[model samples]
Target: MTGAADAGAPLLEVRGVGKSYGSVSALRGVTASVAAGEVLCVLGDNGAGKSTLIKILAGAHAPTEGTLLAHGVERQFASPRDALALGIATVYQDLALVPLLPVWRNFFLGAEITVGRGPFRRLDVAAMRRATRDDLALMGITLRDVDQPIGTLSGGERQAVAIARAVHFGAGLVILDEPTSALGVSQAALVLRYIARARDRGIGIVFITHNPHHAWAVGDRFLVLRRGTSLGEFGRDEISLEALTGLMAGGAELDALGPELDRAASARDPA
Candidate 1:
């Protein structure tokens, strides 16, 4: 994947964005960007304002200050629908899926398509099934059958389905929130593979997670957030996995925790 320096302008840019509630500030001067076909990994620990940033991007909350630019144009998102209208899709960790529903049904959940005229209209089941299969295949995804309940699929497969649905709906940017948090090693790798696939297809990705290893696997750029502000942003060529992990751990803080963790391990040891 190309680095941020060569990916052209960002699909979405948040410049000096801040959020406040009365006298308390939740986020301060946070800046980041995600470009077309570029994966910008936002790395941070808890309370690092990651959620606040995502909420602002998803249009769930307005920024108290600063601007959000989409395609080089300044604008404020009125709602998630407004963002969606601009082709920004947010797939939360939960995935917003109906577990009991069949894969095809969940694929076309809200925006169901129908065949024939008004009075004779019927759910275009066959069309949706075929399209779903074809889209997944295009993204290197394969499902045993579109008729099975979505709950039967593994975590990674479900994430792929959500991604494919976003692509099929013409999303230019996809914001994924901690997509691999609950998955096993193999499952997490599967999702990361699809993330790379998404980037190769020219869809910008904002990957939010605390795991530096996962970020290093597919990120074109890295943005480290701490206590509501940005540590800084670096291109893939500019930062190493070791540096990223150190930054996320807050250097001296991680150093202090190391001995404590070792002692804790000793206390728990049977020997």
Candidate 2:
């Protein structure tokens, strides 16, 4: 496992990071940082380059420009395994889980616990179940059965399991890609609570979402993006939920359309 980062340096830092594909640029000069025990929320609309940023951070793609620093030292990730080796884990919207597999199975999918030697080696089912239950409990998730199919759990519960798996395996930084996008209010709140729980445990998180309310609920800092460019990075005290919402919805553009919208409304009502 990687050691603690230098004091005052973020666990992960992107300095002027940019990505391009021949004639097109997917990201440009975007910068952000996530420190231990901090939640850095990345907010943006559909085409705001959030996916692109996640890919770069996850080592699925290389940036065309700028530097990525882990533990205050500059480095480039060759693949997802490289990022994983540095204790960086990403949980995307699809979750990469098998619907038929039990909760504990999915929790230790790629990294399973085993016992014995050579040909006698076998999966430690009991140990995995115990650890899965204990880890999820640490995140305030109490499952009735870790043996149930993962698909049997609610959306929020599945997300919580993914997070617990990352934390259990020593992930220092976790990048969550729209984990609560498709859930209802109560379900979304459950995931947000888990996020806070992870933060309290001193894990760095990059939470990507389009919802300002969700972001504000667990974020220590906010980074707003639009059309592949970064608007700015703000601390919790530096920005309000309202301002963040306005930015996500294009405040200037909305202001320009307000008069036209009012005219249209009056014409339709004529009252």
Candidate 3:
């Protein structure tokens, strides 16, 4: 736990955050927070500035305006490594695992365990394998073999592994990027379960997705974005899944389009 955890502040929070690329504003005045053991769901359609927000949080890009608070103190992340050092990790949709590598290898990819000292130092393969298997099991993921290539696993399984890896690596806040977008219904359900598991373990989660149903399933709070601006942020109890979906899909726009669509249909079939 960091100072923020002890002080009872959100594990991660962005207050009035905004980003600009030259004259184009990609995001503006977005405020949200994720406390330990909570999941904040960010929902948006394409060109809604979700990616820009993710980059800011992940430290790949700095915010042009507003504040980023980690644990209670306002801080600017100079790089992704700075965020990682503070126990913040982002798992993008790609999973960041090498397709040809074994599951256990991928789990300990950058942070490997070694034995011996000096010239005799060598990778502790056996130990890494056991740890990976146990950690995955702790996250409710069971694999037939830890030696199999990560590419052989299903999308859901890969996501589960990534989440488990982040948890094992001491991430207090994990930002997930559209983790279930391309997954099947059942696969998406599995990933959501793992997210719940992470939340239960007292990890703060930022779940970025376009699916309101999935967001509603595991989110404690929701932030809806459209065209680089926030519609609003609401607690789970304050909004229904339908309402969230409507906001994400731009309800007012859809309502206006409905009449035009109906007229077009009638034009094509006038009895």
Candidate 4:
């Protein structure tokens, strides 16, 4: 949707990354990189290794082969906390929010700010409330009240809050796993707008989704995977929307669907 990234170094890079479980290969020799202010959309159908890729990037799993580089240096992330320490944040579709908690409370759920010292410390509720309000406002997300239960918000709004929270917590790379999958068309558009807002603020985004149209709407680069392997990765200029869709469905597979659909249409003709 925007111009290519500034040609700066990637904030995160995966070089020939692979993961395996016993004899089952979940990911094989996949490679991609995302620079600051860029959106790299990873598109694939089920069993395409997208989940494995997310776990590796989020440090939930370690790669059995190849390398992961952060800011051009090779490093291993032993846990999710290890990756978070380096400003890598992953926002799953469920959002990991407590539906019963107020927006402000949920905003600072695990990482609450505190006042006073030692045994006298107390939750800085007012500070968190204001921060939650103002920060979401800056991300173009205007909530009616920070006191409302987060579950009352629509799917898109909840995802926006998660994205804003990640950015506020100083995450440089935000990985969104199917953030728009459950939303209707209008709500999905709202989430896409939030994603663009994140990119404009100099955050690298790895947007993983099965919908090529959703990914195509905001992606600057595209990566396709099939059956646990990397089909290819292409820049925005190098790939078209049609080509992206075809590749995600597998070129030959979609071609086979065309004639069957044409025959189905003819069978329904009154003439």
The TM-score that candidate 3 achieves is 0.94
User: What does candidate 4's lDDT look like per residue over 82-200, in tens digits?
Assistant: 88877889999889899989999999999999999989999998999999999899779887789999999888999999999998898999999999888999999999999998899
Q: Estimate each model's TM-score.
A: 0.93, 0.94, 0.94, 0.93
Candidate 1 lDDT tens digits, 98-205:
999999999999989898997999898889999988888877878769899999988999999999899889898999999998899999999999999999999999
lDDT of 3 at 17: 98
What does candidate 3's lDDT look like per residue over 1-271, in tens digits? 3544445889889999999999999999999999999999999999999999999999999999999999888889999998998899999988899999999999999999999999999999999999999989888888769999999998999998999899889898999999999999999999999999989989999999999999999999999999999998999889999999999999989988999989898889665
Candidate 2 residue pairs in backbone clash? none
Distance (Å) between predicted and true CA of 88, model 2?
A: 0.7
Winner on TM-score (1 vs 2): 2
Clashes of each: 0, 0, 1, 0
- The lowest-lDDT stretch of 10 consecutive residues in candidate 4 is 1-10
Q: Could you tell me which residue pairs clash in candidate 3?
A: 4-71
- Misplaced by over 4 Å in model 2 are 1-7, 262-271
Query: CA lDDT of 102 in candidate 3?
Result: 98
Q: What is the C-alpha lDDT of each candidate?
A: 0.90, 0.93, 0.93, 0.91
